[model samples]
Target: MHAITIPEPGGPEALVWAEVPDPVPGEGEVLVEVAATAVNRADLLQRQGFYDPPPGSSPYPGLECSGRIAALGPGVSGWAVGDEVCALLADGGYAEKVAVPAGQLLPIPEGVDLVAAASLPEVTCTVWSNVFMIAHLRPGETLLVHGGASGIGTMAIQLAKAIGAKVAVTAGSAEKLARCAELGADVLINYREQDFVDEVRKATGGAGADVILDIIGAKYLNQNVKALATSGRLAIIGLQGGVKGELNLNALLRKRAAITATTLRARPAAEKAAIVAAVREHVWPLFEAGRVRPVIDRMLPLSEAAEGHRVLESSGHIGKVLLTR
Candidate 1:
C-alpha cells in the first residue's frame, strides 16, 4: 500500500506518496480499497504541522473518501465486502487502503458516481450538523455562509436553500460569488471588496441573518454578531483567520443569540456516527432527488496529492479538489 506521508511538515511539497504497510480492519471496522479522496483545509493544516491526527488514527492527511469495501472486521454487519461506499474519516483517506469504523460508512447516493461521492461526506456532515441540526435554520429565514465557494460553503448554500431558507454567502471574487448564486445563494458578497455584515443585513431588509455558518472565526466574530438577527444562531466550524477574540456579552444578551464552535475531526466515534446517520437520513435524499450535488473543482492522480494541496492552499479552485486512484 502507498499513502501520502509528511516526514517533516512544511508546505504542499511536504506531502510525499510512498509505500507503506497495509492497514487491517479492527473490531467493528472495515477495510476500504480507496478509489478517491478530497483535499480539505484541515489536510493543509496537517501538512503544515498545525493539526495532528487523533490518537490511533492514520497518519495520512485526508478526511473523506469514496471506495469499495475489501473486507469487514469482527462484529461488522449489514455492510458487505465489495459494497461501493463513501466514508468520513478521522485521517488516512490519502492512501490506497484505509480502515474505517463501520458507523462512518455510507452507501453512495443514487445517481452519484464513486469519485464524486468522495466530495460529499465531510461537507454534508459538516453543513448538516451545524446549519440544520445545531442552528435549526427554518423555511422563510435567512442563513449566511462564509467562504461560499468552498466545499463546506457550497454544500451549506445548497442544503439551506433546499430546505427553503433564504441563503446569503461571502466569497472572495465575482466568479466565486456567481457560482454561489448558481447554487441557490440569494445574497452574494465579495468579501475582498465588500462588507458581509452590511450586505447580509441589506439583503434581508435590515432583519439580519437568522443563522450564520462561519468559517473565518475571530476575524469576523464582531461583524458576524452585528449581522445576526434577533435570536440568531452562529455555528463556528473553522478558525482560518485566528483563534482569539473578545465577545460582547451585552450584544449577545440583547439579541438572545447563541454561538457554537465545533471540529468534526476531533469528535468521538459515537458522535461522528450520530452525525453521519443524520446526514444519511436528512441530506442523502436531496442528492437522490437531484436537489444537491457534489461540487468538484478538479481531479488529480493520487500520486500527485502534493499538487492537490497546492491548489487548495492557493484557493484558486471552487469546491473540492479530489485525488483519484
Candidate 2:
C-alpha cells in the first residue's frame, strides 16, 4: 500500500507518496480500499506540521474518504465486505487503503457517485454537529457561514436552506458569492469589500445572525459577536485566521450569545460515531431528495495530492478538491 507521508512537514512539497505496509482492520474496524479522498483545511495544517494525527491513528492527512469495505474485523457487524461507503476518518484517508471504525462508515448517499461522496463526510459531520446539534439552529433562523464557497460552506448553505433556515455567507469574490447564492444563501457579503457584521445585520433586519459558522477564528471573533442576534450561537471549527482574539464580554453578555469551538479529529470515537449517525439519519435524506449535493472543485489523481493541497491553499476553488486512486 502507498500513502502520503510527511518526512518533515513544511509545505505542499512535504507530502510524499510512498509504499507502506498495508493496514489491517482491528477489532470493531473495517479495512476500506479507498477509491477517493477529499482535501480539507486540516490537511493543509497537518502538511505544515501544525497539526498531528490523533494518538494511535494514521499518519496521513485526509479526514474523509469514499471507498469499499474490503474486510471487517472482530466485533464489526451491520456492514459487510464490498460495501460502497464513505467514512469520516480521524486520519489516513490519503492512503489507497484505510482502516475505519464501523461506526464512522456511512452508505454512500443516494444519487451521489462514489468519487463525489468523498466530499460529504467531513463537511456534513462538521456542519451537522456544529450547526444543528450543538447550536440547534431552528427553522426561520438566520445562519451565517464564513468562507461561503468552501467545502463546509457549500454544504452548510444547502443544509441550512433544506432545514428552512435563512442562510448568509461571506466570500472574497463575487464569483464565489454567486455560487453560494445558487446553493440557497439568502445573504452574500464580499468580506474583502464589505463589512460582514453590518451586512449580516442589515440582511436580517438588525436582529443579526441566529447562528454563525465561522472558519476564521481570531480575525472574525469580535465582528462575529457583533453580527450575532440575541441568543445566537457561534460555532468555530477552524483557526485559519489566527488562534487568539480579544472578546467583548459586555457585548456577548448583552446578547446572551454563546461561543463554542471544536475539532472533529481530536474527538473521542463515541462522539464522532454519534455525529456520523446523526448525519446519516438527518442529512443523508436531504441528499437523496436532491436538496443537497457534493460540491467538488476538481479531481486529481491520488499521486497528485500535493497539487490538490496547492489548490486548497490557493482559495480559488468553490468546493472540494478530490484525489482519486
Candidate 3:
C-alpha cells in the first residue's frame, strides 16, 4: 500500500507518498480499499508534529474515507465483502487500504457517489454531534458558525437551516460568505472586516445566537460568550486561534450559556459508533432527499496529497479538498 507518510513534521512538503505495508483487519474491524479522503485542519497540525495519532491507531493523517470492504475480520458482522461504504477513522484513511472498526462504518448515503462520499463522514458526524445532539439547537433558534466556508462550517449551516434554525457564519472573504449564504446561512459576516458580535446581535434583533459552532477557540472565547443568547450553547470544536484565552464568567453566567469542547478523532469506538448511528438516522435522509450535499472544492490524486494540504493551508477552498486514489 502507498500512503502519504510523514517522516518528520514540517509543512505540506512533509507529506510523502510512498509504499508501506498493507494493514490487516483486526478483531471487529474491516479492511477498506480507499477510494478518497479529504483534507482537514487537523491534518495540517499532524503534519507539523503538533497532533499525533491516538496511540495504536494508523500513523497516516486522514480521519475519514470512502471505500469498499475488501475483507472482514474476526467478530465483524452485518457488513460483507464488496460493501460500498464510508467510515470515520482514527487515522490511516490517506492510504490505499485501511483497517476500520466495523462500528464506525456507514453506507454511502443514497445519490452520493463513492469519491464524494469521502467528504461526508467527519463533517457530518461533527456537526450532528455538536449542533444537534449536544447543543440541542432547536427550531427557530439562530446558529452562528465560525469558519463558515470550511467543511464543518458548511455542514453546520445546512443542518441548522434544515431544522428551521437561522444560520449565521463568519468567513474571511466575501466570496466565502456568499457561498455560506447559498448554503442557507441567513447572516453572513466577513470576519476579516466585520465585528461578528455586533453583526450577529443585529441580525437576531439583539438576542444573540442560540448556538455557536466555533472553530477558532481562545481568540473568540470572550467574544463568543458575549454573543450568546440567554441559555445559549457554545460548542468549541477547534483551537485554530491558540489554546489559551480569558473567559468572562460573569457574562456567561448572566446568559446562562453552556460550553462543550470536543474532538471526533480522540473518541472511543463505541462513542463514535453512536454518533455515526445518529447521523445515519437523522442526517442521511437529508442527503437522500437532496436537501444537503458534500461541498467539494476540488479533487487531486492521492499521490498529490501535498497539493491538497497546500490548498487547505492557504484557505483557498470554499469547502472540502479531496485526495482520490
Candidate 4:
C-alpha cells in the first residue's frame, strides 16, 4: 500500500506518498480498499506536527474515506466483504487500503457516488453530534455557523436548514456567503467587514442566535457569547484561533447559555460509533431525499495528496477537497 506519510512535519510538501505495509483488519474492524478520502483542517495540523493521530491508530493524514470492504475482522457482523462503505477514521484515510472499525462504517447513501461519499462522514458526524444532539437546535430557531464555506460549515448549513431552522453563516467574502445563502442560509455575514454580533442580533430582531457552531474558538468566544440568545448553545469544534480566552461568567449566567468543546478524532471508538449510527439514522435519509449533498471543491489522485493539502491550507475551496486512489 502507498499512503501520504510525514517523515518530518513542516508544510504541504511534507506529505510523501510511498509504499508501506498494507494494514490488516483487527478485531471488530474491516479492511477497506480505499476509493477516496477528503482533506480536512485536522490533516493540515497533523502534517505540521501540531496534531498526532490517536494512540494505536494509523499514522496517515486523512480523517474520513469512502471504499469497498475487502475483509471483515473478528466480531464484526452485519457488514460483508465487497460492501461499498464510507467510514469515520481516527487516522489513515490517505492510504490505498485502511483497516477501519466496523462500527464506524456507513453504507453509501442512495444517489451519492463512491468518491463523493468520502466527504460525508466527518462533517456530518461533527454537525449532527454538536448542533443537533448537544445544542438541540430546533425548528424556527436561528443557528449561526462560523467558517460557512468550510466542509463542516457547508454541511452544517444544509442540515440546519433542512430541519426548518434559520441559518446564519460567517464567511470571509461575499462569494462564500452567497454560496451559504444558496444552501438555505437566511443570514450571511462577511466576517471581513461586518460585525457578526450586530448582524446576527439584527437578523434575529435582537434575539441573537439560538445556537452557534463555532470553529474559530477563542478569537470569537466573547463575541459568540454576546451574539447568543438567552439559553443558547455554543458548540465549539475547532480552534483555528488561539486555545485560551477569558469567559465572562456573569454574562453567561445572565443568558443561561451553555458552551461545549469537542474534538472527534480523540474520542473513544464506541463514541464515534454512536455518532455514526446517529448520522445514518437521521442524516442519511436527507441525502437520499436530495435535500443535502457533499460540497466538493475538486478531486486529486492519492499520489498528489500534497496538492490537496495545499488547497486546504489556502482556504481557497468552498468545500471538501478529495484525494482518490
Q: Each model's C-alpha lDDT?
A: 0.94, 0.95, 0.95, 0.94
lDDT of 4 by residue, 152-225 (tens): 99999999989999999999988898898888888989998999999999999999999999999999999999
Clashing pairs in 3: none
**TM-score for every candidate vs. truth?**
0.99, 0.99, 0.99, 0.99
RMSD of 2: 0.7
Question: How far in Å is the alpha carbon of 210 misplaced in model 3?
Answer: 0.4
Candidate 3: how large is its RMSD?
0.7
- Model 1 residue 169 lDDT score: 92
Question: What value does the lDDT take at residue 181 in candidate 2?
Answer: 89
Candidate 2 TM-score to native: 0.99
**Residue 101 local lDDT, model 1:** 97
Candidate 2 structure quality by residue, lDDT tens digits, 96-119: 999999999999988999999999
Q: For residues 46-146, what per-residue lDDT tens digits would candidate 1 score against the true structure?
A: 99999999999999989999999999999999999999999999999999999999999999999899999999999999999998889999999999999
Model 2: pairs clashing at backbone N, Cα or C within 3 Å = none
Task: List residue ranges in candidate 2 displaced over 4 A.
Answer: none
In the order shown, what is each candidate's alpha-carbon RMSD?
0.7, 0.7, 0.7, 0.7
lDDT of 3 by residue, 5-30 (tens): 99999988899989999999999999
